[model samples]
Target: MDIFSNLWLGASTAFMPMNLFYGFIGCLLGTAIGVLPGLGPTATIAMLLPITFGLPPESALIMLAGIFYGAQYGGSTTAILINLPGESSSVVTAIDGYQMARNGRAGAALATAALGSFFAGTVATILLAVAAPPLAAVALNFGPAEYFSLMVLGLVASVALASGSLLKAFAMIVFGLILGTVGTDVESGTPRYVFDIPELYDGLNFVAVSMGIFGICEILRNLEGEHERSVGVKRVTGLMLTRQDIKRIIAPVLRGTALGSFLGILPGGGAMLASFASYAMEKRISPNRAEFGKGAIEGVAAPESANNAGAQTSFIPMLTLGIPGNPVMALMVGAMIIQGITPGPNVISDEPALFWGMIVSMWSGNLMLVILNLPLIGLWVKMLTVPYHLLFPAIIGFCCIGAYSINNSVFDVFVMAGFSVIGFALSKMRFEPAPLLLGFILGPMLEENLRRAMLISQGDPSIFVRSPLSLSLLIFAVVVLALVLSPSISRKREEAFTE
Candidate 1:
């Protein structure tokens, strides 16, 4: 009852004319970018975060989250029509979807993807509303030691995110923690690594680092060569799925939705896992599993459903626990921090409108995407034709403007440029920069909580293990480490991400 009441309050805010407008724009932008091959939500969100600086936090988050899931909706179109996956989760969809297109069923493939995603997204929204409150309640009971241990668990889980070496990811996180320590010490008020520069006292600018790693470096990567791809849009006979097609997809859709909703709440690659796992499971259960790599609709239905559900539910940790599950959520965390709001268990009580409105907007945005994407599919396809050389310049301009506007300081611009090179170097070394952003974002909190735990225990080292909850979290972290290092899961994990 209370959840419903809170949702009602959220709907009132999210459905306000201006908030609805932001949600629509975000969905439109997300779909446009998703239709563009070689682009993803992380880069788009990082680039557009500056635009949301002046908006209300509720509207801003609504837009960002909308963009995130909207990409899923549009990714299928490209995957089906062009044999190219615009979103990571759309990879499996391409295996069957593009074949269907080649076989003159592009409409069927696209329609199945849209409908399946809608159904799964709706189910996952309800699940999120139901699951989030209990999770938040549990998080509220966590002591400083518990929080510290939880963060350690999060960092450890992120190490599993690396498609390559675990050691490299671990090194990147430690490097990020070092970057996080640049600001003044919260406890002593003494600067830790400021290099006597006043600008460094407040810590490295997150936007700068994020933009460098995700935005500017991406632009530089794009400029490296003149490779090009074209989107081919097939004329569709109808948008309607036949009765037999619906009957065939119903079971796979349900199963994928269930799988995705469960996996989506976990930290580290939940959406990606959901999509890949759904495809693998459907292949195992389908009567025509031999037809998988061809034009099997089950392949399209299952992974699309799972990916949408997963994207919708991935908001749990960031909203409830203050830990980002993926890079997109990390950008969301940075946006919230920039807006002078802290994310975590208290966000629901402290900023209920922002918390619940974002949830309601997700549902709204999903509906909007369904209506907008179907009729405007042509426009999204046309979007893929724009030249990258032109796009990168505009992105660079926006990045500079965004970084400079944060403090109206040129110093931030220089920092961003410097980090751009670092980001480029890290990319060359095959290091994943996302975990570092998580570390940088969580670093100060990690230190603060560790100190608080120590002070509360009168400097006893055993305080972390003394509390049952903290100890449990540490044990979970170890389990996560074991899972990461296990030869079997490691091979599967690599195979899953090979797309």
Candidate 2:
């Protein structure tokens, strides 16, 4: 009943004409980016953050949330049509989806993806509504010591789950933390790394930093391998699934939704991980296992469902605990900060209309994707035909403009350009940028909480251990790190990423 009331409040806000318009625009942009290969939701959002400054917080967040999930719907289009995954999570979708297109079952593959994603998104949204309140309630009880421990667990879990070398991930996290220390010290007005520059006193703008690292850096990388992709698909038909096709996909969709929901709650676990894991699981146990890479509908169904479910559930920790599970969520945290709203447990109580409205808006956004995508398939396919050489220049120009708009200063633009160079160098070294972004976002919070806990204990180091909740969190983080280092688990982790 309370949930229903909250949802009613949300409906009043989400269904407002202005909010619906914003959500539609967000879905439209999200689909466009998802259909275009070199563009992604993270970079798109980072570039657009400054533009949302004048909008109400609820409208801004709802629009951003729409983009995140809408991309899941749009990414499948390229996977099935051209065999080029528009987003990383769609990589598995291409395996069977492209084969289906080659076999002239492209329409069936696309339909399965749409239906599976819709079901999964709905389930995950409901799960978020039910689970978030209790989690926030638990978080509300946390003190400085517990909050610090929770952050420690988040950073460690991010490292354990990140793909590639553990040492590199640690190095990136440390580097990000170092970058975070550049601003004026909050407790003492002394500047740590400002170097006499006035702009450095306030710290680097995250919007500019993210724009350079993700948006500009991506443009640079794409330029090195720039080439036009031919659209192999001309026309599609037979979108309605047969009874036999429906029967085969039911179990796989259910399994994927459950698996993705669980994994999404873990730090560093998101759509890409869920899609790969679900596809692998279906391959082992699906009755149509032999048909996995041969245009099997089950293959298309499971990964699509898992990815959408994972995308939705990944918001849980970000909204409830102020811990971002991935780079996209980190950007969302940045958006909230830009809106002058603190993200965490108190958000639900202090801003019920905004919180509930955003949740309700996700469902509406998913519906808009389904209603809009099928009819707009032709437009999306045509977008893929646009050349990268022409596309990259426009993107770089927009990123530069966006960076300069942050504070109406050219310094931020320079920061963005400098970070782009740094990001490119890191990519060349095979270091994952995700951990670095997470570390940068969490570093100051971690430092603040640690200092507060120390002050409360009068500088006694044993205060962290004295709190049972804090001790448990620390123990859990250590165990996770230990498991990641263990030989068998390490091998499995590598295999998961490689596959």
Candidate 3:
């Protein structure tokens, strides 16, 4: 089918009464959770995975996608009002958004974040539609060798873009490779690392690992820092933009959208990287550079727009090639697997309704977020007042339920609690959990593809270099590794990611 026909099919499915309602519910729940400190889309989606088991694939995906993008919009509310960044992507937003609020421009900052995000989401949705199909078409030509090379490039790119120590990220990737081996080998039917435990024959549960690392560990961290956060302004005034405000933001928003759309398509580059890059670029080239940390509207507009755009476009690789660009997309992968859908290039042809419907739901979710955030700003602010002591118990209880529901086994809950301790320790050591997740998600796929490539070549290592596409991908991976480890480039990466 042509593009228009595809969109029509998607619209019809997405706008069905039930699907639309689920999308709205996801946005509502996503916004509520994202406005709370320490709970981002990764945690939100991981905790909600089991609930989608009873729904149809299309409906389940529509809701999951809604939660991912809606959290991007919700995170700005906390950043602007209370100077607390609810998501890592919103950290830059807090620098200027909070300053604007302190200067009695709270309403304007919130409005800028909402409107800019809506505009960026609209653009990125279009990009996703135009870019994904062609990419998938190209991917249809891949052999096992090519697929293996692509996974290598993806893993290397993730390590390059990961925050903090490069060596540590590499270590995490190796560790994940080891963890991924803890199940029965597909070829040999023999357990590799299960230690004779039947429950682990399928490997560690995805829900258990994600919830413990993202949800339970985050809750533990937040509990230790309980305090009453103050809102800079009790009353938000003048939400509507003036001619001057509109003139100042137009270019920055467009530039940010472009940068974000590009970055979101790269491995490990999602809303967080896009926001940081946009902020850095704006600081260097913006006309109001001197006013950046002092309540500049451009600071609030650029990163907020960039992050939303990145969030939407990051779906491209996941849908087209079964590659997750970041941890949030990784959780979406888990959800898709739960629904018995394998993520790959063929999904567009095999599950067009699910693919197109998810694309359509992004636009609807963004629209819902704009409407919900603009008039109901005070409600989100009020939610921030709930004490931690009353909140964490519910979070832990829900995580426990999610872990157990994955397999109807209490062992999964124990596994989750164990990982929470590991996750907490890693967080304390300043290691980013995202690369570990990327490694974990890609490890099995990498091993399978590599084995296939080897068998096809009859044990010839030259098969990887003999194919032009495979050779090119490996060359690209080498280039990325060099750039990531270079002294000057590594220094710049550190500076860019500094909070």
Candidate 4:
């Protein structure tokens, strides 16, 4: 009964005139960014963070969250049409989606991606509404020691799950941590690595680094090829799905939603991992595994659905526990903090409207994405035809705008360009970017909590082991590290790392 009442309240908040408009705008913007290569939800939201200063916290969050999942819907369009993934999560979609486009089944693939995402997103939102409160309650019991250990476990899990050489991932993580330390020291109030630049006082902006690495680097890479201007010529027609398509997709969608929901709860398990994992699982379990990588409808459905589910449920940790599961979620936490809304267990009880409003907005945003993406499929496909030369310049222009918008500082633009060079070098060296992102996002929190724990324990390091929960978490981290470094895993890791 309480849940029903909360749902009603949430719906009412979501349906309000102003909030509805914001949700629509967010969905539209998210789709646009998603269709365009380089500009992802993370960079987009960070760019818009300043603009949300005047809006209500709930409305701001609704729009930001919309952009996050709406990208999932729009990303598949590019993946299917051009074999280019607009978002990292959509990379797996390209495997089957592009194959379908090549096979003259672009329409079916688009329809499946859109419908599967909508179904999964809707189900995941409901699950989030039901599951978040209990999880938040459990989180309230955690102390500084537990938090520190949990972060250790998260970092270990991220490294384990990443698709590359463990050593490379570890190196990238260490690099990110070092980058994260460029600003003033939080505890000592002393400068560390600023090198005397006025802008360096605040540290390396997340927006600048992310935009440079993702947006600018993508443009530079795309410009190196002559065929960049040639757009995909695949034709799409019809919206109706065949009965066989429906039969093949239903089971995959269900399985994908389950997998995505679970993974989404883990730190670093963002939409990209969910989508790729879903595709891999579907291929491994399906009797027609031979059809995978060859335009299988199940391949499109499972990953598309899982990506959306993961996008939605990833909010669980951010909203309920104040622990961001990914960089984008960390930005959302920053937004919440800016609004004076501390995200934690009390958020649900003390601010039900905010919590429920955000939940309802997710459903609204998902619906908007479906409605917007279906008819616009042809238009998005047409965009793929834009010459790479012209498109790359436009992407570069937007990257500059996105970087400057974060803090309205030109310094960020330079930072982005710097990171672009670094990212390109790293790519050349075969280092995975995702693990680095995870490290950049977690490093500060890890250090902050570690310091706090030590302070509380009067410099006694044994405090970590004194708490059974923390001790167990540390043990788990060590085990995961061992497994990732094992010889059996090293061979497989080499193959993934080669890309």
Candidate 5:
């Protein structure tokens, strides 16, 4: 009953003319970013963060939230149309989606992706509304020790989730953590790793590093093979799915939604995990599993739906626990903090309108994305015809602008360029950047909580095991780590890598 009343209030708030307009604008911009290679919701939102300062908190958040999830909708368009993935989550989609396009089933692929995403998003949003409160209550009991253990678990899970060698992933994570320490120490007021650069005192800007690594590095990679690239052009025959397509997709979409909704609530789970897990699940369960990488409709439907559902439900952890599951969610947390809104359990009880309003806006935004993306599919496909020479320069320009705008520092531009080179080098070495980014984002928080726990225990490390919750979390982390490093698990991991 109370949930219904809160939802009604949320509907009322979200339906306001101003909020609705912002939601539409957000969806539009998000789709544009997603369609364009190298520009993601995180970069887009970071660029627009300053503009949101003038708007009311609810309206600002609604629009920002819209952009986050709407990107998932637009990302699949590029994945299907071209072999290029607009987002990391769309990588799996591109495997079968591009195959479908090559097989002259682009229309069917697009339709399945759109319809599956809509269905999954709707179900996930409902699950979020129902599950967030209980999750928040659980989080409210976390002391410093528990939080430290949770952070360790998150970091370990993230490293295990990386696509490459576990040792390489751990190395990248350690590098990121070391890089995260290059600023003024919060407790001692001592500067470390600054090397006497004034800008270094503030640490590396997340925007600069993220944009440099993702955006600029992508541009450089694309440019290297520009001459060899053939623009994937396919005739648009139809846009609607056939009855057979629908029959094949319904089960995958439902399964994806269930999997994504649950996984997305975990501390380190987000769209990428959702998509990857969905693909693995579909392959295991599908009758025609061998067809998975060969334009299977289930392949297009399952991961597409799962990524969207995960994107929507990821907000639950960010909003209710003040713990971001990914860099994109971390940026949302930054935006919330900028608006003077502290995200935690009390947010629901204290700021019901903001909480519920954001929830309602997610559904509204999903509806808007479906409507907007259907017609814009042709336009997005046409964008692929734009030459790489022209697009690469524009992308670099945006990367520079985004980095500079983060702190209004020209130094950030230099930082971006430096990281771009480093990212390219890392890519050449076969190291994945995503886990490193995750480590950089979580490292400081983990350290802070660990230090606080130690202080509370008067430097007694045994305090970590004294608390039951903390002990359990630590045990889980250790067990997972042990399993990941075991000989049997290593053999399977090597097989996956070889594949």
Candidate 6:
């Protein structure tokens, strides 16, 4: 089959010494951050994005992908050990996992999390390989009108699924779009909002902006409420699972993988949402539901599987249509642009090795995580004892160096600092920053496509409606908005998020 040959090609590239090393490094750093409660993958990746500009596309992306999913593995460790979830997706894991630990089944709970995540990640990677080509093929048919409509659909879906007030999400999106307009106009070759600054001509550097908002801003928030955690976990043993334990986890793992794979393709639906949804579903339908909050192994298996699967499959839309489903993926899109490779359908045909290589690297990365994480559990636990006051300064220093390296200019450092204040202010106002990042990333593309469609139609807006595909996409966006607005669905959404 064509898939076999493609995978063989991917394997060759993924197995290279340098790529493997980077993947290992990424997994290591991801686990370290995941063990530290305040640092999420989004901030970690944004902080490291500028450094990747020098790497080969395959190596850089493979490493980033490893960091993303490896966090899922690491988060479960702290959840089971200390009742503190290293990542948001692991929040539900902490409930039952800590209970299991308290009951002295810490090793079993951890093994379940590790094994479940590996199985889910493997299945999701296979699904990605089988699914991405066709999706990219379909996307290849999109013209400017269709592309514009698709972007609208993505933005609308993002808003519909974003946590917090819809009005605030909408406002952030508009503000991001406005920020995207700061650079020179592509068509007219005129500066719009440069304010006569030479560095502003290229607009705000995405890496700087992202680092400011995610990396530095997170540090600021964490410092405000900083407190040292005292970890007192007992030594873990009994790593092997019984036959009954295996049987109990089988169905939950399968269900979690399926649900996560599907939801991961949706805009704004990533590991955090998938894990929560899966845990909720299992609590309702699981045969051992009565034991849910009292150290249920099913609770450990299902959500860990779902979160890992969701993390992997969330790459679908990003790789196929060049549309990022979440903030992490948006940062990835920015990375691709920095590497001089456009993220889109053409990637498959134009750069098969890089694309397939990244795909294959994910499977290898999963294997590495399983091998690396189990033995490193003690090391990770030790890492958690490092106080925030000691760790945060190093992070801040790295961010500053990365920002300045963008153009070898001090201006970017200033930009990052400025945006950190803005991001902090936005956080104080309770506005979610995910949609804003998505809007900033998609804004220019949306504007370009809209203008091209208008040019083709000689300014006739009917061009969008004349194409059935475009019309359908627009209609779907409207329906999504309508569904989110309905009272019953709104109540359900609130409940789902609250849980």
- How would you encode candidate 6's per-residue C-alpha lDDT over 1-499 as one tens digit per residue? 9999999999999999999999888888788788886889999999888888899998999889888988888888888898989998999999899999889888899889999999999999999999999999999999999999999899888888777888899998888888988889888889979999999998888889999999989999998987778786757888788999999999999999999888888988889888998999999999999999999999999999999999999999999999999999999899899888988899999889988998998999999998877766778878778888888898899999999999999999999999999999999999887888999998889999999999999999999999999999999999999999999999988887788
Output the worst ten-in-a-row residue range by lDDT, candidate 5: 490-499
- Enumerate residue pairs that collide in model 1: none
Model 2, poorest ten-residue lDDT window? Answer: 372-381
Candidate 6 TM-score to native? 0.99
Q: Model 4, range 279-357, lDDT digits (tens) per residue?
A: 8789889876899989899999999999999988999988887777677887787788668987667789888998999
Residue 34 alpha-carbon offset, candidate 2, angstroms: 0.7
Query: If scored against the real structure, what TM-score would every candidate get?
Result: 0.97, 0.98, 0.97, 0.89, 0.89, 0.99
What would the per-residue lDDT of candidate 3 be over residues 260-309, giving only the tens digit for each residue? 98888898898999999999999999999999999999999999999999
Top lDDT prediction, candidate number: 6
Ranking by lDDT: 6, 2, 3, 1, 4, 5
| Per-residue alpha-carbon lDDT of candidate 1 for residues 288-329, written as tens digits (9 for 90 to 100) | 799899899999999999999999888988899999878898
- TM-score: model 3 vs. ground truth: 0.97
State the lDDT at 382 in candidate 1.
Answer: 74
Q: In model 3, where is the ten-residue run with the lowest total lDDT?
A: 228-237
Once superposed on the true structure, which residue ranges of model 4 sit more than 4 Å away at CA?
Answer: 195-198, 229-235, 338-340, 343-346, 349-351, 405-408, 487-499
Tell me the lDDT of candidate 4. 0.82
Cα lDDT tens digits for candidate 5, 251-367: 888999888887777655778778888888898998868998999999999999999988888888788877677767777766776689876677888888989888888888888
Between prediction 1 and prediction 2, the one with superior TM-score is 2
